[model samples]
Target: MDVQQPLALLGGLSPAQFMRRHWHKKPLLVRQAIPGFKPTVGRAALFELAGREEVESRFIQHKEGQWLLRHGPLARRSLPSLTTPEWTVLVQGVDLHDDATHALMQQFRFVPEARLDDLMISFASDGGGVGPHFDSYDVFLLQAHGKRRWRIGRQKNLALREGLPLKILASFEPEEEYVLEPGDMLYLPPRWAHDGIAEGACMTYSIGFRSPNRAGLAHEVLLRLADAAVDEEASPIYRDPGQQAVAGPGAIPAELQDFARQAVQHALQQPLALECALGEALTEPKPNVWFEPAEAAGMLESVVLDRRTCMMYDDQHVFINGESYLASGPDAALMRRLADERRLMPGDLAKASDDALELLSSWCESGWAHAGLSG
Candidate 1:
């Protein structure tokens, strides 16, 4: 996308302007962010998706001054009637299940793919809400159907109500409020408290971004680094033949501690090892995601990545579905384009070397990609 070009989605601000002025700094309320926007997944379809074993979903209800939350495979019969008040059904990762929903996510590609997370759709009855809460990551709340009244504030006190299943703010203080119709969108920075109550039956789409905390990120990276070190052909083993016996056998040896430190440093010293591991970890599929294997086809004309496939690239490697491949020169350029565009045309494929073709064919066979132009 041209960063300088203005977008209706960002309320007439160019991608560059939006990133500079509002991203992680303040809120943006865009009227008609998507003109004439309609729900990508209808009510019935959403409920059906929630019932699928592979999908992550939740059911919440606040009735008679009591709050209830339930994990789903929520059957249609299990849901409250449309007339029921103060109830909601939330379906996570709608993009992974529906083509149109996935296409809708493409609008937000101005952000780096690495930071972009999944889209969630929530359906609610009259007065329904999950309660006022703050998210650790940024979110774009777009109204897709009916109307929702939103109360938002820059929360200072982050305390949550005790003994509740949800992390609802104990003392919610609203600074602004709005009633959003279809096509309206509100962007909130991380830690901004917000609550939305349905005026009637409504559907809302949330586009969220990944914001990994330091400890969680370190945990993932360290595990990948250890795995990479183990896969090496010859890793140095700890040697202490010259060490003297210690009187305190319960305590770990100082020499052993030094060896452990060196081992981690050695892993970090490998050529592009940290970059490869980070890329692979970022592109790894979620736990519930699974692909249907496809038969290898001869003479590929075009190829598109599977919707569930997560692909990314760095200077030295291309990462997909938790695996990494060394890439450079023309082949690397082509792979990078595939990663960016998520598809390659016949003309693009014609430029691929024999090895590249073979690799793409393997991806297709593994169901990570398909042999057809993306619609």
Candidate 2:
């Protein structure tokens, strides 16, 4: 993708320009961002997905001037009548399960894949909404079906209503409002408070970005570093015969303190530990996700990566789903192509050496990738 090339999705601004001028700085409302767009999952299909154990879903109902929310594993009987208004069912991470939703998500690859989260779909009746709230991460709210009236602003009052399951803003101040039609989109940065109400029946797709908190990142990285450190056979101890202890018996010795600091430094000194940890942390599956291994050996002529598989690369290693492998030569080039393109075409896979083919077949059997047959 050309960052400098103007895209209709960005209201004709180049991705570079959009990032510089709009991303996280403010909100952008793009009309017809996806022209003639339709929902990837129909209402019935969405309801079906909501019933599955693997999917996370919620139902919100506003009736008789009261608000109610329910967590799902919902049966069709649990839902409101089709003719009823002011109800909604929201499904998170649709892209991980549905191929069409996954394909739709790829259109936003101009954004770094590592930061990209997943597509969340909301199906609502008239007046249905989760309520006024702000997200800590950036989001692109695309109107996939019908219409939604949105009121958004840069809110200062972050106070929330007490005793509610949802974190709803108690005092909302809107500076802008828009009724988004099908294909229209609104991009909002973190802490930009917003609310959307279904004008009638509506479906919205939120393409959210991940923003890992500093402390959370440190925790994950340190855990990974410690795991790596445990694997090292040599356990060096502090040696300072010339050093004198502090006067207080309770005080820690300076030499031992230095040794502890040095240990931490040494753990971080491993050449690619940080990089490996980052890839692994980002690719860590949500608690409920599980993969079943495939028995078939993948075709040498072509292969396609699984949607849940995360593949990334650095100078000396290729990382996939929290595992890293040293990469070099022709095989490295081929694997890097697979990471970038998300699939190996027949021609591209044909270029792989026999050893590369064997490695790819192993990956397929492990459920990381699948055979892509030739026409």
Best by lDDT: 1
Q: Report the lDDT tens digits of candidate 1 across residue range 1-375.
A: 798999999999999999999999999999999999989999999999999999999999998988899999999999988999999999999999998999899889889999999999999999999999999888999999999999999999989999888899999999999999999999999999999999999999999999998888888888999987888887777888897877988998888899899999998898888898899889999999989888866888999998899999999999999999999999999999999889999999999999999999999999999996334
- Itemize residue pairs with steric clashes in candidate 1: none
**Using Cα atoms with residue i matched to residue i, what is each candidate's TM-score against the true structure?**
0.97, 0.91
Model 2 is weakest, by summed lDDT over 10 consecutive residues, at: 283-292
Model 2: residues >4 Å from true position, as ranges? 63-66, 237-259, 373-375
Model 1 quality (TM-score): 0.97
Model 1 score (lDDT): 0.93
Top candidate when judged by TM-score against the true structure: 1
lDDT of 2 by residue, 192-292 (tens): 99999998889999999989999998998899889988898978866887866567888778778888999999989889888887777777777756667
Itemize residue pairs with steric clashes in candidate 2: none
